[model samples]
Target: MRTIYKKELARIFKDKKMVFSVFLLPVLIMVGIMALVGNLTSRQMEDIENHESIVYMMNEPESFTAFLDASDLHMDVKSVETEAERDDVMSMLKEGDADLFIEFPENFDSLIQGYRQGDEVPQIKTYYNPSEDYSSSAYELISNQSLEAYRQVLLSQRVTDMNELQVFTVNSDNKDMVVQDDQKASGKALGMMLPYFITILLFAGAMGIGTDMIAGEKERGTMASLLVTPVKRKSIVLGKVFALMTISGISSVIYIVVMGATFPKILGGDSGLDLEITPEQIVMIGVLLVAIAFLYSAIVILLSVFARDLKEASTYITPAYMVVLVIGMMTMFTTREAGMKDYLIPFYNTALALKGILTSEVTMAQYGVTLAMTLVLGGILTAVIAKAFESEKVMNL
Candidate 1:
């Protein structure tokens, strides 16, 4: 077994194409994806962090400006002399130069005071960029904050009008949820891309290395030569399958390392969730590398053994990868509590495990179970491949 393994390693290292397929290509794909994610996250963070609500105050509120001065929000409020000025600010906000545009109509303070006294109706016209999604979103957030402030002021005014000696306060009993905190906007972003990354690495490692192991051997007449050896057919299949698993495992490690190195810079801007990686994270990632590599390699080796050539092998593996890809993508579109079915599903298990590791909630039992299942599946696949290798039809081909 040692001799066979050594020889297989030598052949893989000697073949530049195989080396590229097993190692370099997967790393490139991973780095490319990480880079793209970093760019997108940076842009998104910038949009969130530097988003300054552009308040084009057409009518001045005596207290509104003072209230804004006491707050920590980033807002670019300018007194607009005409509709043209307001339009310019609106255009800038739409172009992502500003977070949002706010317009206060004339008699804003008087109308609000009158409404508080129940002597007249309150009408405040605020112009917001409805077309810009972020601008509109910011408008809603600012509006909520503004409304809360208005409610507080109105309540105080009502208390004074009623001649109440004691001041009343309103407090919410809502608990600060941990899971809700974990699934923040940035966490959702991580969840959205993390699964796809795992699936891509798994698919690439399996397909790239597995295609060359079986189909490539047939194409090179090596299968026929190996069949003549005194070694047991099962040993040959095990050696090749083990070799594929090693290659895939190394590729996955490198890919994860690249992702870890790039994550901080990618999610640095305004993504409230920290992308800081720790030693524990590194360990969890290593476990994932081994588990997914074995699982995918076993599946691909089974598919590859049935193909006569690389093209046919790809035909089978491509569709299999597409299925995994779709399942992996479900983590993005669906909520965490979406379905219990995802827990039992193979690809989904890997995806969820990766997600857990990233979010710092991976359990020892889940890791052990995933690893055990992968090994069991790989062992079963080895048995099947062994039988095929000893068959008259497979040897004849």
Candidate 2:
């Protein structure tokens, strides 16, 4: 078994092109692509922040200008008084020269003191251009912050003493009110994403190597020679599977490490991509990764062995790969808490386990169930592979 393993490793290491494609290429591509994405996103955000929004307020009160002066909001605020002026502003907005067009009610002051005004956008292009970032930002700022603030200000006039109305408070200034665990908070943010990536990447990495290792070798007529060798067929199978797992595992590790280092950049600064994994959690993750890799390798190699050539193997693998990818993506949007039964599913369970591990939420029973299900499935597949190896009819074809 050791000799067969060494032989398999030697075959891969001897070929520089294979080594590069299997390992170094993915590293360079992931880094370059993620860095470029990060740079463009940051630059886009900076441009939006620095932009001087051209705002046209139709029927704006004089006091609104005074309110803007007292606040931190800055924009090229303009008034649209007549129909001709409003039409000109609308043209400018469509042409992307103007950022906002806010229409205040004719009875603005009367409606300010708790009146039930119309709260609908008139099914026209009056609020802001959804296509333009500047327009959207300006609209959000004015509607969410400035308008809300001014409404509160108007309400303040009704109260003789603001403190007297405040029998109780909401979100008080005391630090205890905002108490939170940064680690858990970070975990909550990352838990949705990391599992999907881990599951998808593990299968992807294994597929690249496993397909070529089994089906490609068969195409080259190397599989027949290996079968005819003095070494036991089971040893040959173990040797090949282990080699595939090792190479794919290394690829997964590289992916995770590079992704971790570049994650903050990918989301553009203080995006809270940090993970607070304990040593024990790290061990659990490592164990889960191993089991997942093993299951993926078993699935791929089994399909590879069943096929006649690389093309056939790929034909079999692609649908399986798509199923895994879809499941991984499903995990990201999974809002409800997963039960032990959810963790007992094959590919999905591993993803959930990974998510649970990161969020520090998986129960012991769920974790153990995931591990057992994965390992048992892998063992069953390995046994099937051995049976296929023993069959001359299957091997010859």
Candidate 3:
């Protein structure tokens, strides 16, 4: 078994194309994504810091309008008198001229104070064009800050002394923040990066290892020659399967290492998001890596078992690429601290585990369950593929 493993590894590295595909491709893809993400994060942070976004208010009281002037955020505040003007402001937001439009109803003062006096809460509508990412983000920030300011004013009404001390009593002591930087535990960069890297790695494994193990061997006639040897047919199948899994494993590790080594510097330099990932978190990421390798390779092997030749195997494996890619993207869409529903997903578990490891909250039970599922699913795929290999038709093909 050891000899077979060494021989397979040697064979893979000996092929320059295979070595580049299996290793270098994933690294390049990861670095590219990190650079793009880091740039976007930096731009967003800059917009937050420097952009004087405009928000138009209608029928707002002097007190409420004064609150926007006193706030820390940079804003080009304006007042509107009619619905047509409000529509014009919304058009400006849609045209990329204004950030957002805050529509205060004609009875704004009465409605706001009435709501505070245990009456129905008045709806405060903020119009934002969804097509603009920064605009939407700015709208949400301003709306939240405005609501906070309103709350502070109401709270101040109760205090005999309306000073900065009242702001401190209502603000600082009221909210609790629990920070968990667990995403680093998953062995990827901060934010929506780990999932992208995982998806790319899955594609590399399916295309590089999957194509080479099945199709490339057929093209070289090595598989046909190996079958005629004295070794048990099942051993031959297991040997190739193990080889492909090893290739997949290596590819996964390359992705983790490239991202891990570059992420801190990228974050500090451009993204400006800092994190502290421990050695134990890396161990958990390793657990996820092993699980994904075996699971993905087993499935690819099963698909390859049906191929008549190398060209046919590559065609059959295209869907494997699609499935893994979609799953990784879906995992990216979901926030970290994944709920019970995420636990049931297959490819998602690995990404989730990676996210948890990166963020630092990966539990032993989560790792155990993810590992078990990978083994069970991989075992089923291996058995099915082995059975296919045992067929005289497949062997002959």
The global Cα lDDT (0 to 1) of model 2 is 0.80
Model 1: per-residue Cα lDDT over 1-397, one tens digit each: 6666677678878999977866777767667776787788668868866766665666767777777777766877778778887778777766766655556657777776666444655555555667765667667766767756865775676566644654764445546433455334444557567778867876777787678778878878887788787988777777777777777787777666666566556555554665655677677768667767777887887888888888888988899899989988877776645344444566676777677666655576776565566567667877887788778786455
TM-scores for all candidates: the values are: 0.67, 0.84, 0.68
Q: After superposition, how far is residue 182 of candidate 3 from its true place, in Å?
A: 7.7
What's the lDDT of the predicted structure labeled candidate 3? 0.71
For the record, the alpha-carbon RMSD of candidate 3 to the native fold, in angstroms, is 6.0
Best candidate (score: TM-score):
2
lDDT of each: 0.70, 0.80, 0.71
Pairs that clash in candidate 2: none
Off by over 4 Å in 2: 69-72, 81-97, 106-126, 152-168, 261-269
Tens-digit per-residue lDDT, 84-124, candidate 3:
88778878888988878777666877666556556677677
Tens-place lDDT per residue, model 2, 186-267, is 7766677677666666787788778888888889999999888787999878877887778777777777777766676677
Ranking of all predicted structures according to TM-score, beginning with the best and ending with the worst: 2, 3, 1
Which parts of model 3 are misplaced by more than 4 Å? Answer: 1-7, 44-90, 99-168, 173-196, 219-222, 269-288, 324-373
